[model samples]
Target chain A: MLNSYSSADKVLLAVDCIIFGFDHEGLKILLIKRDFEPEKGKWSLMGGFLRKDEVLDSAAIRILDNYTGLQDIYMEQLYTYSEINRDPVERTISVAYYALINIENHNAELTQNYHAQWFSVAQAPKLIFDHDSMVEHAIRRLRYRTSIKPVGFELLPEKFTMRQLLELYEAILSKELDKRNFISKINSLDILVKLEEKDMMSSRKGSYLYTFDKEKYDAKLLNDFVLNL
Target chain B: MLNSYSSADKVLLAVDCIIFGFDHEGLKILLIKRDFEPEKGKWSLMGGFLRKDEVLDSAAIRILDNYTGLQDIYMEQLYTYSEINRDPVERTISVAYYALINIENHNAELTQNYHAQWFSVAQAPKLIFDHDSMVEHAIRRLRYRTSIKPVGFELLPEKFTMRQLLELYEAILSKELDKRNFISKINSLDILVKLEEKDMMSSRKGSYLYTFDKEKYDAKLLNDFVLNL
Candidate 1:
């Protein structure tokens, strides 16, 4: 172990977070303007260098918090970007993390200070390095995650309408599902509670709003649940 | 990128390959003996340092070839393990690549020279650093992959039987699938071509062997083929 600990071959490691959020519009990703050189002024995902003592996941969370001022957001390590010259300056291996945070959860001033803005996945500007691919991969992962688990709750507000849930899924999956079948399948799962309060925003006879039952959701996760529609 | 790049912040980046193969018994992973290291004589994943000019994917292939006498195998970048001290020797960030190769198609002796052997994922020895987690994650990825793609062909000989395909999936996924349903699903997907020859080794009534239709597979990949059972 001591011999392998050579100073000759050490390299830099970085953590870049792609924070995803969903609002009435669609799926959006958090981007921060690069305040430092070589890609200074260019838009990039929220990122930071890994510290000497932080785990990759912890470092990712810390970065997400440092800039956005949020906590306990759902984040996943998507992939490692390791092209030789991915960073023009040096060989830095960046582990990309995709996070799901409520858009209203963070401070607006922090976002402005960091020059961070939310952009729809499709509307995002040309990103630095393999970030476009990173975001692409993260979206795929998000779709997969949503299909398997009750992950729609992560992006949406605490309570949401069935239409909102469907829209969120549609945005993540980038496809349309059979409306009746989608509603039926989700209802059959029995993990969503129909809330009495309904916001008559999207329909004349507004659709019944629903919230994910965490107790049931956790139980189903222990077993398994599939949202194929 | 200039401010982001830290040549002084050099760290060790290692490529660990989770070499997967399938045989009569089940799915197996290639392991190697450490001949020169502080942990010499111990079992480890086949790995090496990232070259200055190589991409992570190429580095994975290079490391696998250097130790296994294998090339042109189906290898995918699985995940990066980056707990700061996970590498006992230094701050090493390991990009794990999961390789699916045919067990019967490789040079066992070349791997044997370096004391490399194939072990069932469950029975593999305790690996150094975060390799244990890497193997676990790779297996999870393998399960997810088996459901969506007909990649089991990569682990089998050029020609195989439906029974073998079912067994491979069952073994990799660690679950039982209804033979009838599995066969029907495989047939509907149109990824396998029934061979004129028969394999009499595993059954009293010789099983009709099949080979993967690579052309059809390539075409089918144009649309994401979801295998439902």
Candidate 2:
């Protein structure tokens, strides 16, 4: 049965992950130092060639877990790059998946063991072989996805201050949005639960903390509504 | 050099086109009857295996031209379907692309030669090999793309009435929209040129024909604005 596809050309398939993390510094992307050649020791996305028996989604999850030691992260298939020479040694088509992980939750020991480090999106180093373009595309997708669905919360702590949410949006959009307008728009969505607790570390007068209402957020995702901030 | 990637798995790559066309009856999709083994004689999306030397974009264009004899149609890469059994015979990953063409512009001879037929989106057949899912995804993408960009114009004739435009949206969305609200929203975009001539086929009063202003539409596409109805 395998011989039936002999007349057809077969190409190597790879999955690359763009892991996005957010912290006090703003949006950051996880990068790895390539441990093998063609571009050994250079910065590139954490990736692996797909095994013959593996599905694309599983291959992506496996790659993410190998680098971050995290599971069930918010990952989405961004785009497929098929430039003939995208892989220097072969005609490989790479499907890029972007994942949003809370910076505080990733396994630090595993990250260091794999030489994975987080760099501020604005200050990311030059990446190898279309990885830079992949990162740029991921950011654009993150911005668009954040506007429609509350996926940015994946990059933040479980309980976060309004200032943190605003900063997350500002960083994703790469713009300084009006605080009042941002708050008003988010409030209108009614998918955040205000808590009595406050984050006292930021200032003498602490800011109130809030958490996402998953049920409401999930319901809102079903309807087509735009959070134009 | 190619032997270096021998250990990596190679999979058959295919391109499936969800060709969308719009006529007086509303949005339709072009489907073809498969001619070869592995689901032969079944109605399926117009597709072909990607050649080794071709990029995905060029492969999609070639497939579209082969089936419809149309050139430069507005095409977009929708998504890649990689289920292990998507193709019963092998592990073939298919990149799905959706193209919008003027229904009247396609070559009738070519379509007939290939036994291609356009079915209304609402009444499309149960296609072969996860193609039904592909069609559904294409429609969802078309709705989203039409909202943000004026790509719906590609499905309509060069000159059409406001009624035709409204019906196109209504069909793509599979719902009736308030005419007044639809017109007001579209007019606000200011990307249409109201012409002196009228399309009198639908009504005796002869509704005025309108053509899209390419420069304005292209400029508006660069901005982040939604034409929500």
Candidate 3:
């Protein structure tokens, strides 16, 4: 019997983060220019090697925090990419994680320090080392997540207009949704708190703002409801 | 600049499979009594250390085939488990995959050779080295997959009665479903074809047998639809 662990080969494990943000422009992802060899100067997802002592989740959190100086963001383990020669330098398996962050909240100095920038997911540059496929998979997962969860709460400002909320869904789904149906469905969820404050930027009449009810949103997280948009 | 990969720690990567099969008894997961130390005789998911040349998907398939002698099974990358000391003997990160197979189709002799046995998912014994949590996660993913895909077709016989289909869903969801509502929702999916044949063993008035429409199933795979049962 091969009873010992000494004979098994060990390989480097990397964690790459697909940090998603949303603004009036649409959904975007945080990308950094690689400063190391093999894919240096190319656009790529922010990533780092997993130390022996760190767990995968912590590694993902550490990488995301390192790049954006943002904490407590909504992040999930997306997928593990393990194509041979995926990393030109060595045999490395990358576990991809995706995070939803409010765009305006991240520190500008931190992003500038790492040379990270946000690009619209639709028009993002071709990425390095299977990162393109990772982004595509993340978008599909995000779309599925949006139907079941109120992702707009994470991406949109605390006080957002109905149009902003609808646009967030449209961007994630990559399609146009009927305005009437969208608002009705959102109303049915009953987790949004309509605010007295109005955003008067779009028109003189102004539009009422809303915020996600945290207690109700947390309840919905526990008991998932289908928002068939 | 730290540009080389030579200094980073490399950890052993393993792939553990939660092989799910369905019989009249309900959903069962294949588990093996470990023959090698450090947890000899304890139940564990069928698993193996991934070789340097192998991808995770291939490693999962190899492990499943090694135990069940089944090939071309429907498998998916579920998640990666990386608690710092998940494995007793080494620093290892396990990428878990789940497979759906027909219980009657696997080779009994091969399973016997490996001391692998099917246990009702509800009554599965305690497993070693974080495997219990792995099974729990797999079952959750299976339940989610059931809502979006025709998983009964993968776990059931080629032609099945409506009772078998309902039972499969019940086992996966662990809840009794309303028969009329279940059938209506399934009918709306338009993926099942009622056949002229009947399973005479169930009753004097044998229930009608049905087979999934492969073309429609393929289409649904490409364009996902919700099955709110």
Candidate 4:
């Protein structure tokens, strides 16, 4: 069945994952050592080929799992690079996907086995092919996504304080957003659930912890659009 | 040279276009009659194969030129579609692009030869191979783009009346927007040049004609964002 559906212009299909993470330090991206022919021992994003029956999203998830061993990750299709000779080995077109995951929830053993390491947004090393451009576009998109939606929640733990949320936005935008303005904007969106509990570890005045109210957020999403224009 | 880059798994690459246009009536899209086997004669978006040595944008332009004989079109790479068997004939992954062009500028003979027709958003025919979904996504993107930038000008004539401008947004959004509010929102953007001419065809009080100030718009684009939300 597969043979009958073959093509004369057979091209190689690959998936590149832009894995994003946020921690107390700031936002980061995961990179790995290739350890294979061509660009062996150099830094690169986690990637794999698309199986005959798998969708692009699944392939991105598969690649994400290979490095992090995490399921149900937040991943989005970014772009496709089809420049001939992008891969020195063949005529490969890479479909890029960006994933947002909590840094504190990753599997350390799996990442270590894959020689994976996280680098701050300002410090990721040079990558192979057009991977660097993919990362740049993903960061721009992350800034855009972070502006409208409560995407900070995606990169944070289940329960977090307003300061952590502000820091996450600061990392993504690479700018200092006014705290008063930021809190007002988040309140205007009305998507967070304020809890009675407070995170007492960070400050003398314990800041209140909030969990995302998915029900209200999804309901309000119908009338509201996230454009931090 | 090509043989040096052979791979074990080869895939098929296809190109799909989201052609947008505007006339006096409203925003329109171009659909072609599928003239080949396996859903022949069904309505489908304009499309073709990607030949070697061509950039993805170049191939999109080539396809648009073949069917419409129009050049210098406003086209952007939207997304890549890679559902296995979306195209039943082969396991083809199509890179989808969206283009905005003035409908009257295209070569009439070429358009007729391809059996293409301009259908307003309300009357487009049922399309094949997930094209309906593609068109739906393109419309949503068109709305987002028009709100954020001076893109509505692309869908109008070089000189158009204020009424035509308002109708363009209405047609794109598929909603009746309040005229006063719409005018204020547009005036705040400050991207148009109101000419000393009036269009008398629309009303007793002739409406002012405006042309897009391209030079000024481009200059302001770097630091400024134009969103109507």
Instruction: Give me the candidate number with maximum lDDT.
Output: 3
Each model's DockQ score: 0.32, 0.39, 0.43, 0.32
Candidate 1, B117-186: lDDT as tens digits: 8888778899876778888888888766555556665567788888878888777776677898778877
Q: Write the per-residue lDDT of candidate 3 for residues A1-229, one digit (tens) a residue.
A: 5334788888999999999887667788888888888888999988889988899889888877776676776579999999999998998999999977767767554555566788888889999999999999998888766644567656777898989888877777777778887787778778889999999997899999999998987765322352110
Two-chain DockQ for model 2: 0.39
- Between candidates 2 and 3, the one scoring higher on lDDT is 3
Give stretches of model 4 more than 4 Å off. A1-8, A107-111, A213-216, A219-229, B1-7, B107-111, B190-197, B211-229
How does chain B score by TM in each prediction?
0.85, 0.87, 0.89, 0.86
Ranking of all candidate structures by their lDDT, best first? 3, 2, 4, 1
Report interface Cα RMSD per prediction. 5.8, 6.2, 4.8, 7.1
Q: Model 4: per-residue lDDT, tens digit, B154-219?
A: 667889877888877777677777888777777776778899999988888888999988887777
Label model 1 with its docking quality class.
Answer: acceptable
lDDT of 2 at A72: 79
Candidate with the larger lDDT of 1 and 4:
4
Provide the global lDDT of candidate 4 against the true structure: 0.75
lDDT of 2 by residue, A10-85 (tens): 8888899998886666788888888778888899898888887888889999887786576777678888889888
Specify the highest-DockQ model's number.
Answer: 3
The lDDT of model 3 is: 0.80
Candidate 2, residues B49-138: lDDT per residue as tens digits? 788898999999888778657677767888888988889888899999887676777755455556688888888888999999998898
Model 1: clashing residue pairs? A10-B10, A10-B11, A11-B10, A11-B11, A11-B12, A12-B11, A37-B1, A38-B1, A38-B2, A39-B1
* CA deviation > 4 Å runs, candidate 3: A107-111, A188-201, A213-229, B107-111, B214-229
